[model samples]
Target: MAFTLPFFSAKTLLTTTTTITQFPENPKTLILEQCKTIKDLNQIHAHVIKTGLLVNPTIAENLLESSAILLPGSMDYALAIFRSIDEPNPAAYNILIRGFTLKQSPREAVLLFKEMRENSVEPDKYTFPCILKACSRLQALKEGEEIHAQIVKFGFGTHGFVENTLIHMYANCGKVEVARRVFDDMSKRGVITWNSMFAGYTKSGNWDEVVKLFHKMQESGVVFDEVTMICVLTACGRLGDLELGEWINEYIDMNGLKGNLNLITSLVDMYAKCGRLDTARRLFDEMPRRDVVAWSAMISGCSQSGQCREALALFHEMQKVKVDPNEITMVSVLSACAVLGALETGKWVHFFIKKKKMKLTVTLGTALMDFYAKCGSIENSLEVFEQMPLKNVLSWTVLIQGLASNGEGRKALEFFSLMRGKNIEPNDVTFIGVLSACSHTGLVDDGRNFFVSMTIEFGIEPRIEHYGCMVDILGRAGMIEEAYQFIKNMPIKPNAIIWRTLLASCRVHKNIEIAEESLQHLVRLEPTHSGDYILLSNTYASLGRWEDALRVRSQMKEKGIKKTPGCSLIELDGVIHEFFAEDNSHPHLKEIYNATENMMKRIKSAGYVPNTAEARLDAEEDDKEASVSHHSEKLAIAFGLIRTSPGITIRISKNLRVCTDCHTATKMISKVFNREIVVRDRNRFHHFKEGSCSCNDFW
Candidate 1:
């Protein structure tokens, strides 16, 4: 306000005299006029003081500017120079305050502004913006409000720079309503004005507001820049608004506004999040260069869409090109590993993180725990949870769920207690894990108490997932009639999963009457799910209701439903090998089949019998034995036995539930071969060791 930059010119400085000790007509006028570097300024100032030249106010002001802005990390020296001035003007104070803010000392900047006011140097428009920025960075709402009062008192409230900084200060303090008021009051909004409002809404996670603000900005005809585009695209990605994202892409193309690489990366992220991977990939390929951000977007997109292998491939490609990844990229990679049960790959990721000495942040730590837990290693999950320095509610919740899913239900409940002891309040998600733990551990009374507490004591109204877990708790513990009654009395409509949970419990308890009822509801809910039909048919066969089972199969045929083939996977030597029931497609199929035959004989000798009751088709006893022996999980286990060394633990991942015969045979095989086998199926883990399973045959 009181100063102008006054276009310092190269020719003007070059034409002037250069020796440090030389005399001029007016030394005070020549103080910084002859100065080129901060070092040169210091040398000249020393000579002038030694020569007894009076440090006039103009010369003093020049020295303040030189010290503050000439070099970085010079704020301390600038403060000393300011104290030396007999009377620091508004210009001198503004320069020092702005310098401190930029030098990463917003606290110092605010303090200097206070001192300037104490000295009775009234602040100009320039001083408020810089000091307000410092207040914004510190989230100092009281100081910012005081500054706003001063701004209005001085009649500078309508000044564009001052008002914008005021908006910024309030927004960063989580006062978006105040920021919006400031935005609406602006008489003539500039592009920077609109961009700041957009930035604030984005920071506050008001995605819909960001979209609405973008529309308002368009209606106002304020031409937006790259920053505005980025904010809008970020909102679109969060909302999964594919149509809006595509429209923005078209607008950018129509206007030829494709200069910034970050804008392109935002487009990539938006399209990827919207499930438009092909479009994302095409944009990715067209880019002349790929930064870590661009690569992370595509990888994250691929992972979210279940193209895990493709995500891994892109990660490897990034590595080959020597582009370093940030935390976002690694998180997506861990997600892919968890979904595919790629334990070795996940371990490699862990090792890579350790080698790089990356911080075990809560997000990353939780992801690592999830990956290990889904890979059938709950111990590693606990270890990671312990290693995390900062544990959020999400971190604790994931650990609890991991323990429950891995059949460590009692341990999970203990962990929940520990989390509570640390004063962390459990939310709806935490209750889901706790209820599932009760289901898995058969703590029916505890489940009932906790379910009631979650609603009445904690004020967390039960969600659909919570109700489903409650059904699972009762159903899983052989309270089949009570579970059916609970579903009938549900306040919320029972989803297919709720009915399915009850049906599964009915099967476990041989409650065929309820099983038929569940099927009737399921037919209207999810008619094409082949799993429900197979489950009911298996229930009938288990009860020796052959005619009913056959009738169910005939109805399935009439409805054009085909049984989803069982599939399993085993990972060895960093390669995932897949198998279907009776699959002979693997390169080592001959060895795998031979191993299966030999393994079945050994397990049978160890007292394992063929559980042929739940076969899809009733056949001769010998034929039934052949059918169960060639199951997908059996083929996968056989492959592991042939390819892996003796005594090495084998692990398999199955898409569906492991059936009765495979579960029994695997237990015997584990004891007979003196090897531990871990199988991760759709819902939970089954660890077979010493002729017993972690589930105790309940699952």
Candidate 2:
């Protein structure tokens, strides 16, 4: 029911008319219209109450607008005055509806519109625009369609404002094609209409369509704005088209467009994502102001491009500069920590997150879980996983991968069962992790069953990675003949990595015939890869075929193929130190060498026999021992022991697989020095403690 008030009468309203005539115009109206502050509006409200001027609908509308639209968070005051009116008009309803929409409470606006309609308050052109905006914000496509029918019923189909909103509603609801049809039927087009479609395409990840429409907008000579450029820059970034991004940057500068923080951040992100870190950093430094997003873009780009250490340093710089990090920033920083296996630093980040009271969102939780898993802390990874309020496929996959890589294959499989019980469908990555767990645990039958079920039950078509995992499972189980037949019968042509996996297994089991076959396929598939030739050489060397080993090396030299030297990274005091095989480039070279010598002597005394046969060096025992002692992992571990306190865990990241000799030596060192060592090699993680490894020496 409409609320009534006896505050206004014919005689009292005459006082407002007399007052307005005496002022030669509507000065009270001007005060209500032009008042900038709530305090000024409050004084005008007092004047309205004293003069009983709200009975004049024009005066009341202005007052309601000033309260609801001009002053934010004053909706209560406007609604109080609106309800006090005996019969609020359409203008007053429109004012409140627009206020609710702008305040991001669109549902409230929809409710108010419903109330207005039920009360028989006829809507104006302004009313439809306001409510349509609410529909777009709410993504209420069904209700928006009903409103469209009403617009046609009212013969307002040709109205530009209403039609423009209809286009926006469809676009935001992921109905881009319907939006396009509406746009095509329009007799007149506005710049906002074009921008709406561009934004829609971007939301749909249709970058190619975005670029096409951008050109179309340009051809139509419709002046575009910063919003258009922002969407275009996003497309350029995702496409990794550095040339196009640079051209857009030039366009911005040439047009003298005002550089807002959003635009600048987009440019920085585009350059960073395109692998132009230097350009990104320069733009980042030159920006007059920086926000968390600008910092996150650069950090994430650095992490994704394998500059993990650099990304961590930038994250520290962000902290020192007092730019608060959001969830995205934390995700990027955690990714860097995972890459470097800097568990100490990752722990500090976790502490900071808790201290800051940041919400443990799924993305951040997954990152923390991944960091612990990669850092050889699977227990902690499981804790993070269980504590996460929400778990997506990514979260579950990380935990499974972490457990599988840490040699907890049975546990990973059990967790997969639990996930299935919860009805959480697994994706391709999850299957890869499950297959890897099967391979690690020697569950051949289970692997085969899962592979078949992946298609028959889950409808997940096996990709190349899944096939590779299956081959690895069979190969690692010592079924060389079966693995070979599996590769031969593969529906998809096995790539070089798949062939290399088979060859490595052949080397492990000393299957000469299969090794030669796998090498033949690998050589043809990747003729220029020095590693491929080196693998063949190693296979021959394992079988004591010196002549064949020499032939493989000779072919490599003839083709100018230089093997990638093994390098290892050890993080000490939050700084990463790198060492190459036999490279004495450190300032403490003499001390590091002496430490390695002492470590080797002690380990030998503890019955550690050096496996010098696998050494590529075809020299005397002493020469081979000397060469193997200075390998990258040994140097890094020696340096770590010499510099760090005793009993401290040493973490190392190796560029290539840890050699058999180095692996054995590291196991002995872990026992001798009473230190736990975690090494992340090219393939998986190895945690050595007390003369044992987490992989049980299978890796």
The local distance difference test score of each candidate is 0.86, 0.84
Candidate with best TM-score: 1
Q: For model 2, how does the per-residue alpha-carbon lDDT over 576-628 read when each residue is reduced to its tens digit?
A: 78899987688788889999999999999998887665454445666877888
lDDT of 1 by residue, 1-699 (tens): 111122234345522233323355454444445455655556655654565553666666667776687665666777887887777789889989988888889998999898888988999989999999999999999999999999999999899988888888899999989999999998978998888888899989999999999998888888888899899999999899888898889988998866567888999999988888999999999888899999999999999988998998999899999998888999999999888889998899999999889999999999999999999999999999989999999988999998998889999999999999999999999999999999999999999999999978889999999999989999988999898889889999999999999988888889999999999999999998988987898799889998888788778888888777888988888788889987868788888889899999998887888877645454466687788899998888888888889998899999898887788898898999988999999879999999999998867
Q: Which 10 consecutive residues of model 2 have the lowest summed lDDT?
A: 1-10
Please identify model 2 stretches exceeding 4 Å from their true place.
1-94, 101-187, 257-264, 285-293, 421-423, 541-554, 616-621
Point to the candidate with the largest lDDT: 1
Query: Which portions of model 1 miss their true places by more than 4 Å?
Result: 1-19, 23-124, 135-156, 613-623
Report how far off residue 130 is in candidate 1 (Å): 3.6
